[model samples]
Target chain A: MLQEHAKLITFFSECKELVGRKRLQKMIYILKKCQFPFSERYQFHFYGPYSEELTLRVQELINLGFLQEEKEKKSGYYQYRYTLTGEGEKFLDHYNLDMPNMDEHIEKMSETSSRFLELVSTMLFFEGMPKEEVEEKVLTVKKKQNYTSEELQQAWNFIGDMGIQH
Target chain B: MSYQSEQLREEKVFKDPVHRYVHVRDRVIWDLIGTPEFQRLRRIKQLGTSFYTFHGAEHSRFNHSLGVYEIVRRILENFKEHPDWNEDERLLCLTAGLLHDLGHGPYSHSFEKVFNLDHEDYTREIILGDTSVNRILKRVDPKFPQNVADVIGKTYSNKLVVSIISSQIDADRMDYLQRDAYFTGVSYGHFDMERILRVMRPMDEQVVIKATGMHAVEDYIMSRYQMYWQVYFHPVTRSSEVILTKILHRAKHLYEQNYKFKLAPLHFESFFKEAPTLEDYLKLDESIVMYYFQIWKDEDDEILSDLCNRFVNRHLFKYIEFNPNHQFEQWMELHKLFTEAGINPDYYLEVDSSSDLPYDFYRPGEDEERLPIHLVMKNDELRELSRESDIVEAISGKKRTDHKLYFPSDFIEALSDDSHIKKRILEILEG
Candidate 1:
């Protein structure tokens, strides 16, 4: 089996159930920025950081019955919920993936709203820049989001809470 | 302020083969087209080595860039009064479209693979760096260059603007598919662009197709699929790319090992060191690369000479369908056999793979970065494209990959009839 598949299944196992495509993309990008071994290449899209490779991997997992995707209509749009299947768990048990602090980190990330995760991931995307510059960029590029300073501060604090220095 | 929105007395137009006439009413666009950086695009081929396979594919990035700008101009014209669209981003969108491919070096793909460079990154740099493009953009506003850069980089806050240029179906892909098809003389890239443009509705964050225009969108998707398989990923083109990549690798290795060249590779010095400045990168064009290849064909290094000769004279390597996963042991044996047969397997033998997902939609739990084409139904609701179109759905998320083992068939055939190594190589390759 490909290690990319193994890593993703392990991620599903850690989170148990992850919802919303945007949230899933943001979570993995944040994890990758925090020095996790997710190897998907991310490009800046309308929805902050997105990885096509991750999406393809998730689809493959679904096709193999290793993961389950449940779609629910929410108001005006569709929402997705993902959970590892029995086959996913069995497949995961075969590989000893040593991802320390992943469960707690993913759980903490999952609990947060997708909208806030977008700001967090966007900030992390410019991780090397000064905090002030990143904030300025977030404000400038994401003008439509109209993120308040309070939300920006909270996102920075959340990133810090994840043990990411930036 | 006047200079920012200055228009020429008469609308300037380039008589284009692809877009018919690339119109320029804005003085800024005219000035931008005259910039040294923009003019440099004439030296860079749009399809790279596809010209070797399709003799007519000699179009330049300059040609494609103008086509992209024209498409955006038409799209924006259609979008003028839409409530969801912002009229203020007109110039920014056009500028971004025109300058999107400004950073592409000569033989961009092979050079990028060899030197770890990205044309998109350079595109941003050229827009923001000390160049004529930056100067022209700054005339609009101090922040104008950054806005255009962000749009091209797909990082602009205005999702609608970014989507127009960088989305799944956008001006760049639209122009390239048609322009490359026109230049290469293939029919695979034609689609109902006018219908798709007419149906495009600006939502809060993206451009959605009306359900009525779903067939046009499907046609566009199938066109992209066919173009990828037919022209873009042609085996002959890949074979040329393989040789081009090896030549760069061998030259870089030779340079690093202090192998003296009859003519010093000054143009490639920074690239070989893997630290090319923006200026160094921009200085290289397809002509400069070919000039070097022409001279390097007679160099002292046999491998370098042979590869350059193969590329320059179109003596390309032939390939056989190869599965690396299933033939690892056989490949290893062939590698040893080639080496024993006095052929360097490193340059002479390679397995290249190319894969593409034709189109994809939001599969329940799967995540995608590409904004899946959405159809706005008659009732003002949105439906994903693949879900709405059977043709798109059939190919959606199906990533097709082709792997080929390329080698010099002429070299193998030149071996003695009874040469044990040659027979064994043929047996392994054929068997």
Candidate 2:
């Protein structure tokens, strides 16, 4: 059975903090690509790779007092921010007893993770472009993501800088 | 934009021989396929020594992996109309289906047997370890990689999800039977997988087929029976497997006795120690194993060199159907005769028995996790498949064991003529 926050608490334990839902999904998706033992499965959904389970699990964590969510009205709509609570930290510490490798997984993910998580996730969001077609696919994908060529490179460059070995 | 419409720029497909086109829609799946670990499957043959029996079985696990994914994809589509289907588990099922065979090494059956390795455990390692596949799975969700492994591992709480890839009538079998049949150019494994999938419905804890598809289920069971005996159990493949097992045993024996060699068995040192690390095990595939076998051909150890040459050159030992109850005296006589003739029976004689072979048409309580296939009756009550389908019932729980006595025919024929031993052995074997 998947615990409410499940490995997400362990994930936040590694990152210290993950801000918005979009950022959280993108980062976790990147880690999933690196082959972390996550239970959420993603698709090339709205805002790069997305997992409905992540949303449900986050809500579950909120109910279970592991994560705190803050909501603010911005431009006539609600924007939310999330962070680990005191209890959440304690929960992570207690539940992560079995995960001796969490720190190493986080370190490896950071090296492979990019600031332009959107750009890289967007690059991967395309269904099946091989190495050769990556350039062309990215060109068209930029329009859908509202990303420029430079931003794509920055995301692509960040992945390159991380050394891509993890 | 709403949160769900993450369409790829285009649909991607792999040209698979059995499934034709293995469609990819998720960027995560496409990337997972590109990872070095997943690509390593290309070097690991699907059926191992079965290639000697059916040359076409040279297809790698990669081919079968894609086929499994495709079958799951089709099955998922069929489940779309069912009310209990959890759309959120869609990606999980597909991911599990694709990566289920991730941990297999080159010549998986023999290698795992000799080294006491389980590919299922390795699948978890690759998914949970700091590998590219793990990284990709993490992107789906932080805990997704493990869930995928769990589904493959059959530990997942979601019974329907687990059953899709693992149960008696799961995508893994549906794909392998057809794919293996296609590669081997055999007709026995062919069944209407499409109709069976169409009739499938997600029940509370199991995937059930409608009663209308009972005929199709019967056909699949029959096909499974045929494939097990006809292709998967071909005596030639078992002969090759016997030689392979003996090779590993001999090498381990030599290493234990501190036997030195012209070419060091570097790849096998861990295995010879009987404690192979994950790293050590990951490094082996068909190519490296073949390289070692080739090296052993010129070794100073005569038995080792001879066996290696036989395996490498496909001069496989011959086998006869051995019924122990009747042939017990003959079997004993062969062992004594071989010993008297100066041949080591330990290396030269083997009794290969295949029972509970993988993908067996098993009944419930026989397997730990799997629930036997159930059919939705006209009154909407669930009925076990074998209870209603005679074909399935006839074969279910039946352990059809094939025993073969394998020995070096050429060596026996070259024995001294005055003993008249070779003549008697040939008469018994030929009969």
Candidate 3:
């Protein structure tokens, strides 16, 4: 497999199941910031650090039948979900690739609400800003500017406890 | 122990002059530093020949590397609570930051130019091949070494991870600016890095600054421009660099011509052959290279001996601003005059052109160069920094190039054969 594909497959295997596009992007972004060796360009997009490279990588995996993207109606909106195919399972077993602590991470990531994920991701986006500026902007950057300084502090604590804070 | 067992029982700190203190928490990082290969960096001067111009620039790459790692460490600590921060790959970021410059040989500018070697290639080899660094990394995981190499190589699959080390406003730049300024004792390269860091935000797959921190970012951009022109591209340092290059060239030429030297540059044999293995390259550093230059001062070849003496004793060439295109014929005439005065024009004359695009913020077609610095505006939108800042916008995409003509001033002054050519050459050069 191409090294890029190996990375994608490995990411998927570590995730343990298919995930939503937003969650996957956040996961990949977290991995990259934490220093996983991936080469994709990202920009501040609708959800947060969006990448055209990742969009294409996901498409390529689906086209090759290594992954399946399914849509489900939830609250009158269609939500996209991703999962590995049977062939993807075989290919993964064949390579027997390993990524340390990815399984536990995927489990924790899966349990996170998208809104809370957005909060943490957006708060992080203000890396070197002063506590006040991060607090003020973190609240407004979201669709609803209702987040509190307490929540922001909690988000930081959560990141450290997870052992991922650089 | 398994791969994760590389974590240290306790953190170790290096008291740094630039960053104050550099902390290493992981055993992998500590082991990598302790490796002989990494220690070799201590013997290689960070600024190379710049020390000849700025006496204070005697720091080594090892010092700069630690500074880079410390900057990354702070940035990482700031990142810990970001919802998108991945806890597992924490060590990878630290490792890449620490070992980024591992492959650099002695007097890298001359070594790379004369021998066609890139320190990056050696960085990869050291991180992935049968080296102590690779062993320490592999003990973390077999793929860990390659993964770390890929980050330094700028081919890693994760864009944000790559940016931490290689981006326009990443850890590498943040550290080098302050560290270099501190060592060079120059006022340039000073920016509110703490402010810059404070305003940094992890935007999904890229890092950005808050709009409130725009001024600090602008100061950084301006500082970079000033440092490039003031310190990095200083003519005196370039003159020392030119002399250093000429010394290497003369040695290679004499060796190729079968002139038996009083001291053969055995360490530089592979380099003289223009093909250096990783081991051969690793064995070289500024001290070893300077030792050879010192001994070559009394060599059999007159040109080599003279050039070596000039470089070893800091007798650098003198230079004047000259456009090669405009002064082509005058330059050629001067070269001819030098040859008549019994100086080898090839070894004595050179033109050095240095340029920098102070900042390049997404010029439509050049989006991939670096993800331009972004500022998270209060309106819940992101704007490219140059788009919002007039100072950055003015200099963005504009490359300022400066050219200078260099020659042996002492040779012209020490002219033996009472020739008018020396006077004519000086007139043309001074004119």
Candidate 4:
């Protein structure tokens, strides 16, 4: 169970890096199309929440080692360029996922979490499961059996306090 | 469909000075905030009679509730991005934040003093019992409401989620400190919240600060220390609280004595009867209390009228620094002199002390469950914050206590011009 959960964690971490780097790559593409230093003439606009979200992703990528930024000496505005390291390209190739787009991944994840909780609750209720049985089943369903003693204890403590009585 | 996608028809924004704007994206959070029960928080003062001293502290629990919700929103946003974070805890955290202070009644400090009520227990009841908040949370799932209540009760096993809302330095404290400082206009409460948030890391059992951010944590602790001394324990605020407490005591005493009040205590009936329901609490706010206080200023009962006049008209009792250990005899002597001067010592003379022992280094046998702040090092090893941080160590485990003797200076001045009693009182006050 622990190994499976670790694999899940690895997947999530990699996916996050992929999405972030991909977003950065797209911003670089847009920047390159506009010029070395971005100009208003590039038809690039950040007008809405989606644009704001992409800007946050770009900032994260810059914070990580994936992208490089330079401030224009005259304009005093930041110009971002992708400096794809060996690791970055390898990550991109492993996923076979294209550069980021401001699509619905976050919204999808939220829906997935809500659905996961609902499904678990429904199944437990349907089975007339006892409290421990329900928790055990939920843990198994999530394939989190390989958690550290402290992690398992913490999860159990949370489960007990969450009042997930069947 | 998931509740997150079910946006409000028209986006509702709570104009919170602390959070700037508490944006309601979900219909559930929006509906819950609009409910009459929740709206009543607008009428209830957050700091109770503390406004008498800190005039700028007129903000209500409604403001605080919104601020708490906003902080939780940001924390959950961070958690949602983390791999260890379970996204399922999002709604629970939000619900707990919104409804945490729902059970607070008007003049909460005084009401609790006289009525023996626990607001935390009431918070749970309001969430899990029959209420608008409960109904909205339940709509998400049958157990969703209970999950919220459990979080507020600190019984939820998810330490990370629970700590975000209820721990020593969680969303509740973060909101109240920043919100209280913003309203009271006190510099002492200012801390780099952005820095604190950046340093926050979720561990298995609780949230810990990264070692690099220890200074920020120390700054937060110092801010809390200053707030407690400057705002929370202001002598003028305590004086008003003392007067407010005496007013209730006097009224309750009169009611028990079968004293015929000119205006019947209709609003205080349930309170006098000792069992107030949700409706009773909902009707009791600072406005309603002030309305009754305005009316009570005309009552024939001298004690009641005078107390009401003192509270409403800003005629608070004056106080002097007092040492409980050394000034015990002096305080007792003043109590007798006060009675001789025809002033009730019980109502007029009060010894109020406020103390705070800031963050402590974890000592196992010396202090049980101290929950010392942990800082995760670059090596992924957890270190007790005070061990490596000099600023935190400087003030850790050091307790500071302040005592003050409060009394009516006006009465002393108005006493007979030739009275030596006034001289004695003045001498003690001067000392």
Best-performing candidate as measured by DockQ:
1
lDDT of each: 0.85, 0.74, 0.74, 0.64
Tens-digit lDDT track of model 1 for B1-431: 48777899999989998778989999999999999999999999999999999999999999999999999999999999999988888999999999999999998878877787768789989999999999999999999998898888787778889888888889999999999889899988899888988999899888889899988988888888788889988999999999999999999999999999999999999999999998998888889999999999999999999999999999999999875445656887998999998999999998775521212332322343446778899899988888878888887754555568899999999999999998999998887
lDDT (tens digit, per residue) of candidate 4 on B1-431 = 67644776787877767777887777778878878778988988888877787789999998899989989888777667777778867777887888889888887867876775656557767777778777877778888876776567554557577778866568988888888898888887778888888878788767888887877777887787778778887888889988988899888888989999888888887887778787676677778888888999999988899999999999999988776434656876888888888999888888764421122222211111224577899998988776787766676543455567888889999998789888888888889
Q: Rank the candidates by TM-score, best first.
A: 1, 3, 4, 2
Question: For this target, which candidate reaches the highest lDDT against the unseen true structure?
Answer: 1
Q: Candidates' TM-scores?
A: 0.84, 0.70, 0.71, 0.70
**Window of ten residues with lowest summed lDDT in model 1 chain B:** B356-365
Q: Is candidate 2 or candidate 4 better by lDDT?
A: 2
Q: Fraction of true contacts reproduced, model 3?
A: 0.00
DockQ for all models, in order? 0.22, 0.01, 0.01, 0.01
Q: Alpha carbon lDDT of residue A125, candidate 2?
A: 50
lDDT of 2 by residue, B1-431 (tens): 31122445799988877777889987777888999899999999888899898888888899989989999999989888678899889889988999999999887777766676767778888999888888888877788886897687564657678888877788999988898999899878899988998898998767899999999988888888899889888899889888998898899899999999888888889988878777787787889999999999999999999999999999999888776434656776877778888889999998775531343445532211125678899899998787787767777642454567889989988987777777777777887
Tell me which of candidates 1 and 2 scores higher on DockQ.
1
